[model samples]
Target: MHDSQVFFELLSENTSKEVWADSAYRSEENEWMLKAGGYRNRPLNKRAQQSNRRKSRIRARVEPVFGSMENEMGGLFIRMIGRARAKTKIGLMNLVYHLKRCASLWKSRQ
Candidate 1:
């Protein structure tokens, strides 16, 4: 559930209504998310099940993102001299890491 809002925003921005996200987006407010009358409905076939499994795999990709943010970019807990400076530095480092990730993905695609 780390960066759930970011995950939601990425899904909404990148995917169309025709793509189903499996059982990951469930909420108390919206129980029947993937079971609704849209691309989310089960196709009653093996291929659809495989596709749903692949959709579920999308959640796994974020693990590497978190790993890089923690390990390659430095651990999560910051120990700076001042609170305000530490907060600002941490935000900058996070932004830098995200940009590096995007660039790496873009380069790999090309």
Candidate 2:
């Protein structure tokens, strides 16, 4: 399937009833799909903009980690062939991140 089809497929597989996504995922078809799947729409559109401010505050804390991954870890690109290998690569990257963070904290304490 295409990337767009995969997105909907993921939506269908999700356990949560409330979907929090970007405005780019907004559309009549997606909305209908979400509704049919018993999901609460929380796309970042104008009508829902106020709710996103609080979500954005929470998301801000997580954003810097991605920034560090890009700038420090040379990006989160897993150039592996399959999902299993990709998962392992990401797992190793996360392990490296934790080790680095631990070392930094230890040095700060010293």
Candidate 3:
């Protein structure tokens, strides 16, 4: 989680002021750092308690999209060797997902 924040900051060229994470990301040091940086920390509590039910509902909706990507769109693994090749594969996978999603929407309207 820490490394990901650094990478995101580097790529975005801006500091992230908000983060949402699971209970595994809970830590006093992380919390302190986020607070000091004026970030809105949304990690689940140590006892796995959710602070907001709305967030949980949003996560429930988002998880199924990832599950569909892994199961239906073949995004679970990349057989390629290099980072560039892996990125290309994932990009194509995402393109396919979008195409299929659009087709489904069009068909539903028809």
Off-target runs (Cα >4 Å) in candidate 2 are 1-53
| Candidate 1 lDDT over residue span 1-110, tens digit each | 55444544565565566544434555653335434524454454788678768976986876776677788877777788999989997788778878998999999999
Candidate 1 TM-score to native: 0.39
The alpha-carbon root-mean-square deviation between model 2 and the true structure, to one decimal in Å, is 10.0
| The 10-residue segment with the lowest total lDDT in model 1 | 29-38
What TM-score does candidate 3 get on C-alpha atoms? 0.46
lDDT of 2: 0.77
Give the clash count for each candidate. 0, 0, 0
lDDT, candidate 2, 6-96, per-residue tens: 6787776777676676667777888888788777654457756877787889889888777778888889877889999989878877788
Name the runs in model 1 displaced over 4 angstroms.
1-62
On the 0 to 100 scale, the lDDT of residue 67 in model 3 is 83
Q: Candidate 1: lDDT of 94?
A: 71
Clash-forming residue pairs, model 2: none
Model 3 local distance difference test score: 0.70
Per-residue lDDT tens digits for candidate 3, residues 1-110, read: 56545643543455456566555555786677667767775646655565467578998977876787898876677788899998987788778877888998999999
Q: Which 10 residues in a row give candidate 2 its minimum summed lDDT?
A: 39-48
Q: What pairs collide in candidate 1?
A: none
- Tally clashing residue pairs in candidate 3: 0
